[model samples]
Target: MPSEPAPPSSSLAERVARLEARQEIEELKYRYLRACDHKDPEAFRACFIREGADIDYGELGTFATVDDLVTLFERIALARHNEGHLVLDMHHGVHPEITFLSSTEATGRWTLRFRQLNLAEETERVLCGDYDDRYVVEDGAWRLAKHHFRSLWSLTRPLPKGYVVDEGAHL
Candidate 1:
């Protein structure tokens, strides 16, 4: 039997650089999700590029600029009702697949397990989706250039009467 071909080798510096880039991109995704859950519009906006970003959140809306998305996000996530937030959200991102297209550009795919509580409507929603993203190094940091989310499934149900939710100290 013929011996298997040798795998390509990269220098230690190159390997380390690639690893660091991947870590930064992963952190970026985490920050984005956390910002959404926490209703931090500034942090959420910081995760994407300054301009000309392509964002498509399906039924939520499509935006050419990060600012546009931020506006809508503020309206929905920051709404107040009865001395409490109108909507509460939790985002859990998993199964990240990051692929490097170049030293300064990359693509990532992630699965999002999202849950939301609408206090005004007394509904609980659960959704699962896939995020297809493009990242680029801008001003020495990785920022999202393209973000598209395709929802796989979602369910919404009315909360039981007299149900109580403990928001905890975090809220």
Candidate 2:
């Protein structure tokens, strides 16, 4: 049986719903940038769908599910506190171009520009990259289904060239 087409008004409502969902997805992306740069793995995990969130960090390829991402984040937490000698305080700014593919699904391409500071090495990489993401609505909230990071241009400078590194600096 052929289904009746949606009413004009219903179509408009659907458009509005998709727009609102896109906004929510964009906010989730922003939080991901903030939490990841801060190395707050717990906060980062909260943005995932809880079932099949995939994080592909370019070289790492792809993680199977959100549980796998959690395992990856556990490693990050341990390393940030134990493994790596380099200390970092970074600020990441995300500007995303978001598209709503459906009321439940969307995609985003985000540009990331960041400033990094290493208290131990006195080095910084002013880095830039693109993040392609897929977001979905689950259990009344938007969560990342998949994320891929592709770095474009990365430049390093000697601590901003004459900028003194104070003790316990936060980029």
Candidate 3:
């Protein structure tokens, strides 16, 4: 087989930078998901810019700043806990396609599989969606500039009747 010519050093450098950006963005996403499932609104808020961050979670209401989302998250999560409900949530992001429009800006698409079990309500919900996100470099760190998702499919069903539910609040 004929050997291919090596690319210029600049090309290689760009490639490396893109790869690093992708990894960093992926880690940022994981952090956001973990914070959400763990019900840590503060950690979740850290994943985005403190101000002027846009968030639209469909029926969950749209917000102009990360603080709005954080407040809503805390209120809903605390309400669930106080209602004797166990909220088990799982977020799986897959098939990410990220494009770097500039050194400081990028866009990404991801498929998300989200499942939630509300023990007090005896309901299990599964949601499949796509996240359309925009990123920006802020203070030398990549932060979520805009985050939105659309649900492609979802299902909710009741659990077995008369089943006992455990309060696994202390995880």
Ranked candidates, highest lDDT first: 1, 3, 2
Error of 3 at 45 (Å): 0.2
lDDT of 2 by residue, 1-171 (tens): 101233467676676666676667777877877776666777788898888676787754578876677677556433442344245545464666777666677788888786666645667877788888888888888888878888787777666556654424341
Candidate 1: 10-residue stretch with minimal lDDT = 1-10
- TM-scores of the candidates are 0.93, 0.72, 0.86
lDDT of 3 by residue, 1-171 (tens): 101232466487676777787788988998988988888888898899868887899878899778888898887665555536467788998888787778788888889999988776779899999999999999988999989989999999998778765656574
- Model 3 deviation from the true structure expressed as Cα RMSD, one decimal place: 4.5
For TM-score, the strongest prediction is 1
| lDDT over C-alpha atoms for residue 7 of model 2 | 45
Across 18-125, the per-residue lDDT of candidate 1 in tens digits comes to: 888889999999999999999999999999999999999998989978999999999999998766799999999998988888889989999999999999899999
Q: List per-candidate RMSD values in Å.
A: 4.3, 6.1, 4.5
Give candidate 2 regions above 4 Å deviation: 1-11, 59-61, 65-86, 89-93, 160-171
Off by over 4 Å in 1: 1-7
TM-score of model 3 vs. true structure: 0.86
Question: Which pairs clash in the backbone of model 1?
Answer: none
Off by over 4 Å in 3: 1-10, 80-85, 162-170
